[model samples]
Target: MTQHTDVVVVGGGQSGLAAGYHLRRQGLDFVILDAEAAQGGSWQHMWDSLHLFSPAEHSSLPGRLMPAQAGETYPDAGHVVDYLTDYEKRYDLPVQHGTRVDAVRRNGERLLVEADSGTWRARAVISATGTWTRPFFPAVPGRGLFTGRHLHTVNYRSPADFADQHVIVVGGGNSGAQIAADLALDGNVNVTWVAQRPPRFLPNDIDGRALFDVATSRRRALDAGHTDTGGVASLGDIVAVPPVRAARDAGHLHAKPMFAQLSADGVRWDDGSQSDAEAIVWCTGFRPALAHLSPLNLRRARGHILTDGTRALGEPRLHLLGYGDWTGPASATLIGVGRPARDAAHEIAGSL
Candidate 1:
């Protein structure tokens, strides 16, 4: 039997929840299918010490504000989990937990969302499946030759796992900086951070809230057909979160040039200098999780679907939400996903 709804939202993460909120406002009957048995989405897989760059007040989904933590300035992963669980119950959003969507295919006028549990026929489908499942590990030469433990950001849980080991942290993104700082602060590991280029940190005062505001401004300007390069990303790559800042000030968070290749014991620089290590952490980012949508044949050059707003250019019944700016400005963040979610829901409602 195929269940039917106005819209079928894939993934019950922040993006999916945001879309659900707006879809409810539009009075459209919809269902959110989540692979996880519980709430928290990608936050559930975050490192034990991971904290948002912004305060709880600044990071929230649509309709409800995230409650402030008692003693923490920034909310941690556990807090986010609690909030997401409560938010779902508060709104009574129809979420089918433990349902893993296998594929999404066109079925005449509706979309057939085939899942392990069952299938859903929806007039519109919103792909809010954020990139957590698809961790990108760059093809570094001689990576397979390394005899030590190599892990990506997704596999990292805590610094204690690599305690007393000399660890080489790769990539210059926020994950690399934070993980390196986490290990350094733990005082149990010898951390050597490396990036392709020098790491750039935003002002100490700048946080996720400030970044979202700048992104909003840049988005508005771009939408109005004006030239704008005023996004927070233009200012820097790293957000100088407290842990990262502390590690930097303590001389424990400096990044060297990325190694040329991995050696049997560790990594070798382009200058032929070698550094022995027991482990390597790749903090590289992720690609969008769109494998289920493969049946649609809607992908473009960069494994992304061309979209006019959140709606797919080739398939009007499909909307890509919370992937990145191409889907909508800052659509990947907790607070940033709301606008695109609203637009996606609104467009789907109007079309329906």
Candidate 2:
């Protein structure tokens, strides 16, 4: 069956929901397609101890503010899931669960969204599928030959699974720091934290809210035709989340240089130092979840779609949201997705 709507939103996470809110205000009929069986989106897959770097007040969607969780300075994954669930119901957004989008391609005057459940033809398509679904693992030497249990951040759950084992956590970003600290704090697991460069920690007082402000400033500067002054990255890479700070202060979360290679049972560093480990966790980041749009042949180098803001340069009828700065500054974060989403909906409404 072919369903018709003014817009078809891919992914029902924060970004998609934000887009839906603006679309509703714009009075556009739209449907959100979500592969996840339920409401939480990628937050459902995060490790048990994961918490937002910002407070509940600062992390919110377009139309609704995330309710504060009592006794928690920073909301955990579960809290976020509950907030999203409530947001969906409160707004009465049209969402189709468990529908995996297969392809998005042009069909003359409109775009065709082919999914496992059904097909939808829409005047515009907004792809808000975030990066969580696509974890990026660097091509490290001897990775294929490693006999240990190697997994990406997406597969990691809790420290219980890796207890009493030597584990190597690779990557320099927040995930790497968090997981490394998580394991180190367990005391049962021997952890080797590896990063390409020295781990940089932001001031303890700074958090996601501060980072968002920095991003906003940088965005305004760029919009005013000024040189790039840098954003959260200029301050540091890791936010001194509570657990990470504790672990660092306890001298349990020190990072080592990137390894030279991996062995069947261990890793070899550039200085010929060797450390045996039973597992390796790749905390490396993720790429945009954009395979569904492959049929359009819009991808350029580095898996990026050329875009002027969120609108694809190749196809103005399609907009990419919440991927990263390319879409909008801090667009990937909850508090940051609203502006681009609003702009995208505004542009779509005007065009239609």
Instruction: Candidate 1: list runs displaced more than 4 Å.
Output: none
Model 2 lDDT tens row, 1-352? 9999999999999999999999999999999999999998899889989999999999999879999999999999999999999999999999898999999999999999999998999999999999998899999899887899989999999899997999999998899999999999988999989999998999999998999899989989989999988877889999999999999999987898899999888998899878899999999999999999999999998788999989999999999999998899899999999999999999999999
| Models, CA RMSD each | 0.9, 0.8
Task: Return the number of clashes found in candidate 1.
Answer: 0
- lDDT for each candidate structure: 0.93, 0.94
* Backbone clashes under 3 angstroms, per model: 0, 0
Per-residue lDDT of 268 in model 2: 89
Model 1 lDDT tens row, 143-190: 999999989999999988987899999989899999999999999899
C-alpha lDDT of candidate 2 relative to the true structure: 0.94
* Model 2 misplaced regions, further than 4 Å: none
Candidate 1's error at 229, in angstroms? 1.0
